[model samples]
Target chain A: MVTLNNFRKHYKDFDLNISMQIPAGTVTGLIGRNGAGKSTTIKAILGLINPDEGEVCVFDKNPREFTPRDKEAIGTVIGGNLLGDFITAEDTIAILRKMYADFDEPYFRAQCKALELPLEKPFKDLSNGMKARLRVLIAISHKARLLVLDEPTAGMDVIARSEILDLLREYLAQDGERSVLISSHISSDIEGFCDDVYLIERGEIVLHEDTDTILGQYGVLKLSENEFRDVERQYIVACKKEAYGYACLTKEKQYFVDNYPGIIVENGSLDSTIILMLGGR
Target chain B: MRGVLEKDFRSYRKTVLLTLALVVLYAAFCCLMPGFDLVHSVLFVGWMGAVAAVNEVADDERNGYAFLMTLPVDARSYVLAKLVYVTTVQVHFWILARVTLLVGTLLDGKKPDIPALLSKGLALHFGMVALLMLILTFVIKFGVKSILYLAGGLVMLVCVFCVLVVTKPDANWVDALLRIGRFPHIGIYATAAAIIATAGLTRLAVHFMRNKEF
Candidate 1:
């Protein structure tokens, strides 16, 4: 369980004010574009950056005040390259084994082998996909109750990405006590795995709701110039216009589809929904 | 804590080895060359301090190992681990120096009392470690290169002051060290205690770093 209450952090150029909660036994996705403060949110939660205001608690304990037991229950992977270029996968495992008492070494080794990561090669020597997989393997091997991942699949190929997704699903399925919070630019990954989605824009949360509910409710409305001119302003959430037509977006996609049967309708993907909600695709 | 130290050890193995080799070569050169005991000791201390200071400052964060920040490791443990590593490296170099000195004396048929040498070395070792710890605190608080520049300037200032102090007809090098190294044993103890206290302050810095949102 994690809770952030009116958390605010400010830099010279950027600011973050967020209020969020991740309930136990549920996967939450943090969705945002580049420079949208997704990483800042994760950093604030990890206590890597002290919040200028508000509070963050993990399993009811503040990150700054976590007891040993509380810390032991949490694991985090903040980057696709958790181990630096000079460190090898074997070196990472050895160091982790000593730091985390509950680390499952054999299981971790098996995962590494299956993932085809070279244990003895330095991290810089590995491909980006290999490094990403290795990072996930390290985080999951800790036997932690909560796993926080930031862009863990950002550099992987389609197959590698699917493998990671499958591994995460398997983790949730087998371990009922565990919860996950993963942030990625890939909207489909978030849609496929996250139970709830948090869409952030310019350091503020725009929406937090069930992934399916948001996806099902929003759609794009393609209109010719005359039709766009005739449409109600209030109904159009966002519109990208050109000489040929206007591509209008609306939150009441189902209503638009049923009422305007003659108009063209396309099933809205998560990406489009975010683009509309954030007012930028 | 053991984990942190082990990782630091493995990570900086190259630097540690190189430092050891340099210390041995310097000590041997000091013994072989005539009348350089005091200069050798001071240079040895300075060299070891510089190496320990740089390694302490740069090895972790520069190498992208800040993910260690996510672990349950306490700030105190991180500082202690660094101190332990510097001290361990110091001990290894000290042992190598003693062995080299003993072998040199054996070949020359001039055996100094081992107990007396050991006592002096132990005192010097504790003092050197304390110095390294205090210097490392500053290095971590500032950037390594900045600290190195500041230290160099300070050393130059001290050398200038020493020359100013000993501009008399009979002020030899031995007299200079004797005059300089002479504060009471209490002064050394007090300085060592201050160094150890700085380690606590460095822990707070680590906490600030860990909690820094980046």
Candidate 2:
């Protein structure tokens, strides 16, 4: 549903060059460290910021030239750009009702009631969790075909994060053709939720893998110097020297378990993957 | 654009109501009190319109433009919506000012001649709103500090005007206003000029908003 073709954005101290595709019916997670060009990529996708080079296309049209119909097809919860803080939930409902032609008022009201968001209370008065919920609610309630969520669950407790994820899960379950591209610093959130994850560091896309492959097939082999030297290195995606010996990130976890018996074949987690990819060779 | 206008109205509803209430109370004060007349009504309308427009601009900035840009709105639509909202606020006050004029005439045992009062009041209201648009379009471009500067400048001007008023209480302000009001179709021309100026301002604002980073 969204495609970036060698998109290049250059700031004074940073340069971002990325190409990726988010097909319909998929949930893609963009995992990154702070200042890793995640927001810039998102801004480009939303047409909020201009790219110095390459193309950003949503539904086959440049995002900058997207018409109302194109915009209505996508929903967004961009960071630093949320609903008016002084307006109430009822006011949000009213505003959104007018904004989106297919905006489901009853659905929004029901969800608000279900989420325990006070309709009469001003948004500024709502708790942070409530505010987060309202922002997500606004994005999903309009029946958008694609959701570009930029850290929608940021600054929330675990439970609040789970609730936000649950909302997304419910949204995805309802439709197969709908897509989501969520950018977040929280690995665990993206790890357990998204189907695929793209690891970005220092404004470049370092790794992109299916969550299943990252979780189930990938492994971190903690090895002695001799063991590391003797082991086959083709499957090793990244590795770093440790005091004990070396820590190697391999895509073939089962191969190591089968061949190197009793070795420290720890499961590859999002966090470990990030550390190795970003901090290791 | 309709959606943005609706959101603005909803956000500023209470403030609008309170301003209108002030209008009624102030209108009554001007109508019955000794040194009050059309000029006071003009000043009140102008001040309230300027305040509402600036306040709305400030609130939108505080709210940030991220949420606004995410919607099915382009920069042009966004600018148009803001212009419409500000104009609507002024129109609400303008109509009410006519109401106050009618009530004043009834209390004075004369025919409630609203048409006679329409042109002068309309021209002044539009002129003030136009002046505000001239300020607001740039305040929008330059962001929050410019708004604060604009507010500060307005306060200073008002203070200076107040000082002038206090020092020259004997001056025939009413007669001067009457003479200005009698200028041939000055109201019609002012309204037309304001509309064209505002339209041009909206275009300029659209350009500014487009080039602005969220």
Which has the greatest TM-score? 2
- lDDT string for model 1 (B1-214, tens) is 7777767766666346666667667766766765445334534644574474456445555544447767766666767777787777666656655665565555556767786445444455555565565555554555445566767987998988667666753668646655656755644575576567656655655654444433
For A1-281, candidate 2 gives per-residue lDDT tens digits of: 88999999888999999998999999999998899989888888998877888999998888888776679988898765365666888888888888899999999999998888999998778887888888899899989999999889987899889988999999999999999999999999999889999998888899999999999999999999999999989989999989999999999999999999968999999999998988899
> In candidate 1, what are the lDDT values of residues A96-212, reduced to their tens digit?
888888989998889988999888898778888887888788778888889899998988889999999998888788788799999999998999999899989889998788887
Question: Residue A164's C-alpha lDDT in candidate 1?
Answer: 95
lDDT of 2 at B115: 60
Which lDDT tens digits does candidate 2 get at residues B100-179? 77777677677755567775467667776666666657766887678667768989988876776678756798446446
lDDT (CA) per prediction? 0.73, 0.83
Share of true Cα-Cα contacts across chains kept by each model: 0.43, 0.71
- Looking at model 1, the pairs that clash are A48-B211, A48-B212, A48-B213, A49-B212, A49-B213
